[model samples]
Target chain A: MSEASKSARPDGSNRPAVQLRSAVALLGSFPALAGVDLDVHHNDVALLQGPNGAGKTTLLRLCAGLIGPSSGTAMVLGQDVGSANGRRRVRRSVGLMGHSTALYDDLTVEQNVQFWAAASKAESETVVPALDRTGLAGRLQTVKVSALSAGQRRRTALAVLLCRRPSLWLLDEPHAGLDKDGRELVNGLVLEAKDAGATILIASHDLDWATSVATRRIDVVGGRVVEGTVVEDAVVKGTVVKDADA
Target chain B: MLSDARLIAAKDLRIEASSRVLLTQVLPFGLMVLLLFGFGISPDRQVLGEVPRRSVLEQVSPGLFWITVLFAALLGLGRSFSIEAADGNLDGLRLGGLDPAGIFLGKAAAVIVQLAVLEVIVGVGAILLFGVSLANVGLLAVTIVGATVAIGCAGTLYATLAAGQRVRETLVPLLVLPVLAPVLLGATQATEAALFGPVSDGWPWAGLLGAFALLYIAIGIVAFGSFLEES
Candidate 1:
């Protein structure tokens, strides 16, 4: 397996992996996310909590450079997302997984991991181990991806994401298909990724699980950043509130 | 661009290799189609064969070849997208930084290469079964390449576009086959001339086929990124 495709600007590793300015993105002529200004330092694990269609996915997509903003610009390491080259670089650095369950069901567990590892430019040495870490060790050779159960498939997908060694991680609803043990496995993976100098930003509805895992929280409601607080020691109910308008 | 293209191509070829019996089924299916063509035309070879290969090729060859290739292709294209849609693999690739174009190229290359192999098999079957004689191997090869390239590009595009829809199975072919009519006509006509001696002097119908291939490739590259945004 080859390495994944990460951005290799000479100054890529000089500063933090991701930085965002006033990013505005509209979906269906309505603002999906607007006035999103923030900065994330290297290896910082920040949680984004919001309801469905609260611009969580849009913001993540903006930060990942998967789509362009409606008006304002989003910069990854100070490069614009609107340009093709900028978007490529941002995509290389950022690893995003959401409700879409991005794994390919037709491939086997190992092939699934290897494909992403090759794309993200990750080291090949980690491929087998990532599979093993996700509790998919011996099943590599014969298991077709479609045959695996939901949690098992998510485990394999996680294994693939871990192999990439991305500088920035953008996760939307990361805990979707994981069991309790699987969630712990995800937490370990996130911690391990962070330890490797990767910044983590997760958008999830499971507040207790998310708050426990994150050091700070940003609340988005109806396409606006209503609360961008760095909750030092805040609990889920006290610090986080769903927008009535949402 | 070449390095990126080569990388994608390699991945695509690797995927086709890893899959079980992809080409095996193709050759057999082509042979069966050849048998069907033989049975259909045997009753009236004089009626079908003597009327100039151009007319026969124009009306039936492209559709027949595409029908054969499309049936073979449909087996794997959905699997390509379905693989990603499963367990969030698309997100993994997105997060892993695979360029959507590179990814599409890789997947499309696999389909194109597979279709080419199948086309060769079908061509051989057609020759044996339909009694079509190829006077120019080069022209025939070029024509096949053009048709298959067009089919592959357009097929990959629709497959990606229909990745998550309710009626993806029926919708893809409905979208692709209509747009593919020109390539089918062009390929069939060019192949006929290459087989049954020259019909249009030295114009060489392969050029039209090649142009059509290039056009579809450009469309695939440009529009592929847009399909990823489909809800």
Candidate 2:
């Protein structure tokens, strides 16, 4: 078994993680999500794709407990994420990273992570593991976010995400501003988190990584989702994932 | 449920603490307004001295206090939401599980803090400028506190409602002043009675101000959640 598969069950057991049912969003009071349904079982990485203004962010936010769907309901770990209690349960168990770093520029990287940790009321002891997991060990002690390069700032923000290792990770455009090494490191972290029973839902336009990484893929356009068959095309260095394939 | 309120309020309070000093400085301007009352009420010292200082304050302070408070509160109300809205921070905060009323309380609290500090400065300035002594200082202080609370809640609610409009600055006072006239009349009258006459003299007006504040709090809580839909 790969090291990641072994870590999937720290004690050696498999279990499903997240499920969504008939989730729908309306733009112009019409279905944007279009009665979408999905599942991300334990260790399953899902890629969500969409054209511009296609309810991609809306779907992510709805799952993140940041928004409520107009009609259909959603469930994370068998709990409805839209209800008050369910939203709290989901927020505590999920870490969401988006285009915005959500970091305070003036605070040091460590201070920024700690403040978010404190705000979320996360355990103090978990801070270092979170920082180390994001590969920010060297920068943890010092370095203001504004002082860091674009990629480094994303790492710091990712470190903030690690402060609370949510069971479900929803990332919107997590690959932006990443160099080759940074992207690989982030992909590894996502894969590793999945192995640890953290189901991953990543939205991206770059189908190569999404296909290479995710077990399932969903496509959205104009707030409507269309399912595409997985295609495997070999690339020089990595897999060439083709979703537009007929 | 109030935890929702506290969590949202804490965010705005942290931001508002930085501006409390600047907001309070407007009291000097309010004091100038009070000093202007001296000129209007009595052009010459002979006429002013004929009436006892306490009587002169009782007759003039009510109108002057409201005018000064209205102008000073305009400065604070202008700030309440447009500051947060400038950078899309308001939507960010809403995304973080904060309730709308929580935002309302935080904005109102910032206004209240400013009013309290300004009241102290204006109170002292009013005394210095008009030669009016506060015989019942404790009661007068209470009245100042009440009036400011009325202004803060009333002002914040209006500011938020107008925040998205193109002419929000103009819209805020226009919406607030008409609805809040009773609060002004009550609070200013209460202040006059407290500063110059017996505490009993101000109870009716104080009661009126108290009711106004409560009404604003109630209305703000119920209506704030629907702000984005309307805006």
Give the least accurate 10-residue stretch of model 2 chain B, judged by summed lDDT: B87-96
lDDT for position A246 in model 2: 9
Poorest stretch of ten by lDDT in candidate 1 chain B: B53-62
User: Looking at candidate 2, what is the lDDT of residue B131?
Assistant: 63
lDDT of 2 by residue, A1-246 (tens): 222222333444443455556777665576757676654555556778877778777777777766556667787755686575676556666778877676655457776676566556567786777677666666444776657887887787677666667777888888888886667656777766764668778898866666667666778776656673332221123433222110
lDDT of each: 0.67, 0.66
TM-scores for every predicted model: 0.76, 0.71
Residue runs of model 2 more than 4 Å from their true location after superposition? A1-22, A27-31, A81-89, A101-115, A127-156, A178-185, A207-212, A228-246, B1-50, B53-111, B122-132, B150-181, B211-231
Tens digit of lDDT per residue, candidate 2, span B85-153? 553334334434455676677668767876777777776666666666666666666666667787888
Interface RMSD of 2: 4.6
Best by lDDT: 1
What DockQ score does model 1 reach against the true complex?
A: 0.48
Tens digit of per-residue lDDT, candidate 1, span B91-174: 455555556677677777877877777777776666555555667777767777777787788778878777767677777777
Superposed on all Cα atoms, model 2 deviates from the true structure by an RMSD in Å of: 6.9
